[model samples]
Target: MAGRVVPAISLKDYESRREEITKQLVEAAETAGFLTLIDHGITIEEIEAQFALSKAYFDLPKEIKDKVPHNLTTNNGYEYYVRKHFPFLAVLLCPIKGPSTGSIDQKESFWLQRNSEWPSDEDVPTFRAKTLNFIGKCEDISNKVLTCLSIALGFEEDYFCKAMDTHQPDNLSQMRLLHYPASEGAQGTWRAGVHTDIGCLTLLFQRDGEDGLEICPGRESHSSFAVGDTFFPLPAETGPIVVNIGDMLMAWSDDRLKANFHRVRAKESGHSPDRYSIAYFNTGRKDVIMQGPLKKYPAITCNEYFLHHTKIQFGHNAKKKQEAAAAEKPSVVAATA
Candidate 1:
């Protein structure tokens, strides 16, 4: 069914049958890049409250919001009143095109990272308190989601978490808030373009009733998405979050877990105000180069692929070549001298 909408999982069932829930999550992720999580223990009131706060922050005057510009320390954090031009995170989450066409996504998003500095009582005041509370709660939710992922992947619940901690203080996890304004005339421009997430995994909390996210089947032979050539529109559920595998997770899984391509169209509903969603992304440590298992699939370096992707963006083909030469020069000199 190209246009078919699937039913979502029930929270009550999820809570009651923990083992079964874990299996379903594992199978869904292994075959399909995405799954709708129910009984995730997050409440409707909490989702609404987070959305309300996001709206309040976004609704502020553009000038007022622009004070906190995107910073590298924050890594594109706090983008206000604009859609995201850096669609790699979005593209990397899902790769819609077989060969990437380089058409960037057209949605605006705000990025937030964990605060490294101890806040001065007066510097942020109440805002700091609210943000910390919100992020702390969401981080817990994200960790639980990761735990589920561990169970599904046939690994210890702490496997990914502990491996990720190898590069402490600068973990790859991130929180992104999106606002999709109604696009009445824009026929082709999607809220997001077809791409894969660059990191390991992603958990999304979206508005309860609105539906826009669509997923394509996996490209691998065992992929669930391989059943069809068409896209599957995600069914809306009240207060449940959508979980999806990303490139990094796929890398970790030795290509067993697919990071399929997906896209979001501009909201068609005239009645609904702008759509708001908060997504958390997890990443592996920078120092640890990702290497897939050779027993299962061909061995490939995660860091090499990632560096290649980033280098594509920066026009650093020459620099990369030079670095490669430099790396080999020492070995050559050692052999001779």
Candidate 2:
């Protein structure tokens, strides 16, 4: 089966259906690595507003958008990574390349992290405030799902919740706004490259028929890319948000749940020119340490594992130690407001 849609889940009435919900969640995570969430309490109207905000922000003049450059030290703000300007080191592992490996993923993004600087409401009137509420709702829903996942793994309901420390001051959870422009008939190009998320869980919102997302299910190892791996097209229903397991959760489950590899517009599937989506990554508090329930993996701070994993998977040039420290420390400086 392609990506399946789990029934609507309610945090308020959680216990009544805990067992059933846990079973479904576990099965999907172990086999499909992707699931759609329905009746998640956050309405489609609310999500559409967030999507509109993403569009408004990206539509800004180049000067206004570039003012907020996303970099290693400041993990938030706008990132304009023209596929042509990519560094050689970063492209070594990029599977599909043109005349040069650097020119592969053509995309633009805006990242918002917990307690990080945000564009003022004046810039995108009421966006900063509304989006914060959207983030809160997503975090709440993610915690509820984590609760069920813990039960599925035979741990206390709050085991994963406590490890996430969602309310902590230095939480690394983020809600990212992404826009993938049309390929313009550009061959051998993608909106985003093949990569796995670096978190415990990711809640993704995409408008139906505005599709480009693809997944290689059950393919976890970064070094190996197989042609026969299951490449599934996402179910792009208008009402539901997609959810997937990430590296941290995969490690926490001792590889029972795989960190699925995915890419956006990686093929000539005739995707729409304008694609917009929101991804809320539950990276957990940088200080919260994690290990598999069976001690199958060594304990490491969330921050440490994230940076280390990104370095190996994406070949990021940042020093691991410095990146880990940057994740925890309060802003001495920020890329933008």
Candidate 3:
């Protein structure tokens, strides 16, 4: 595969270079559907501190982490591998295996939304305060990107910003902290499965040297599976945030933008190191209706769109779980006999 062609655009003098930045961002969205942002105002120190906090949270006992288990209604709090598919069941019971590898993503995540009730600071000192501060920085960058995209798509500069207003009670935007545990070259396993972000935009921060992120360029379908696509590596590098277009944004643009498939796979050779990354998902508020000027698709509320996408992503998994359960029933009956 060719080395990275994903554009790394600078946000330096953003006010002065709005037109140039907008052009570059729109171009990347149309082609690669992924790009990196440098000089975007968040310091390396701040990023590191947030990573530290993430580690501290993940280091806690499973029971402690489970205290804030992810809520399906709100899409916030802690979640283990494929837990979102069967919120009340264990991974063994609901194995949402990936199509290519037939293995579950070996990762856990903590999601935070604007109105999420954070984990107690007593568990991880200043976790709430520090995380909220970092989230604000991420939101600022996300809004700026949204502004650029708005202008590129011929909408008012604040159109997306207003639709995704952070202060709104129904806003669904989220900051996710992800941890992929170290593995001893587990065959068929992946840190994450191939999928596209479900929201409008995503800003991702990865720790240097923990590379596994890859993307399949030129994907035309909105489906998470890459049918005939080739994947290319996107190494983890500190400082710059990797940004990508998401399903909602593509729908909002009437397919002008792309939401490409991406994944984090296990290394083929040696042991795979533990991986850590943070992502800010910019989703429109629940009540906000999304439809581009071209109206190529049906107009839908953000909440309904999210539900439709979630069903597409995990509906098969639920069916598979039932089939697996049925297949195991005979064995259990014989063993009991």
Candidate 4:
């Protein structure tokens, strides 16, 4: 028989029978570090509408889209028609930069954060209204899922929610709209190079496609499946948003749970069509210390790992940028010559 399908949980079901469901969720997390969630209570119609809006926005002329070019100033908001490798390599908490370290993702991305307060009527008009509604729905799902996480980890219902509350200003949620050009004769590993997410959690809504996603489960030993060294393709399912724990969650769990490493390989040479996916990233509060829950698992802090990795990876990138800048300087070139 084929492998067991990944378990999908509903928030309502979880709440009514928190004890049993929490056990299952925690067990699944410990083993897989990822799970597909169904009946998250978000409707497919809403998801489809959001996708339509994203497509409309992306379809705008590149010149018009450039008005909101991605920049550090607005926390990299509204990336449009941009092609570049992942930024903040060090901050991403990966050993090797990533599968797409040097090469760029074959798609454009747009970023957005949680609005501090509801936007006024005039700023975006219809756009603002739809965005706020979408975000509200997403936030509800996030809160409910997080509550399950608390229960799964044997913490009081409000533990993580309260800690996260203080960092509401830095919710840093992102709505990334990706458009992968038609792969007629593409020569590469995949549309999005192999990489794991950096945030605590990722919620994905992918457009129509038979298959593209792949996962390489973390291995307990050096010798294991070939996917242990590379990404293994995962088939797309009809419902239940694909949810994966990222480096942040692994760190928060104090090694109890792992961050799933996954990647996408381009579709069959002749059959691959353009692909699109919108990912809703739930970035933790900037200053919220992600320590292991009290009286849960071994005592450790996500902050410790974050600082450790950040210092190493981030410092390296900063140095590289500095070196590149120096090399580009006219005076430096003249002196060298």
Cα lDDT of model 2 by residue, 45-135, tens digit:
8878888888999888878887767756646778776442235533443444443334445678888865777776767788778888888
- In candidate 3, list every pair of residues with a backbone clash: none
lDDT of 2: 0.70
Candidate 4 is scored at a TM of: 0.75
The list of candidate 4 runs beyond 4 A from truth reads 1-5, 80-101, 116-125, 219-227, 294-337
Which clashing pairs does model 4 show?
A: 90-314, 213-234, 214-234
lDDT tens digits by residue: candidate 1, 1-337: 4322232444455445767666666677777778776766777987787777777766667665556655533344465333322434334434343323244445556676665332233433355566566667666655665676676666677766654552364355667778877556554346665546767778788886666787786556222223233667785555777878786777677677778767766554343345678887776644444554444544334344445444443332335533653464222111100
Per-model TM against the reference: 0.73, 0.85, 0.87, 0.75
Candidate number with the higher TM-score (2 or 3): 3
Q: Best to worst by TM-score, what's the order?
A: 3, 2, 4, 1
Q: Model 4 residue 134 lDDT?
A: 79
TM-score comparison, 1 vs 4, better candidate: 4
On a 0 to 100 scale, what is the lDDT of residue 78 in model 2? 83
TM-score of 2: 0.85
Candidate 3, residue 185: how far the Cα is off, in Å: 1.7
Query: What is candidate 2's CA lDDT for residue 312?
Result: 57
Better of 2 and 4 by TM-score: 2
lDDT of 3: 0.81
> What TM-score does prediction 3 earn?
0.87
Estimate the lDDT of model 4: 0.57
Candidate 4 residue-wise lDDT, 125-214, digit = tens: 465578667767766666666677776666778655654442354344565667766666554445665455666667777755635776
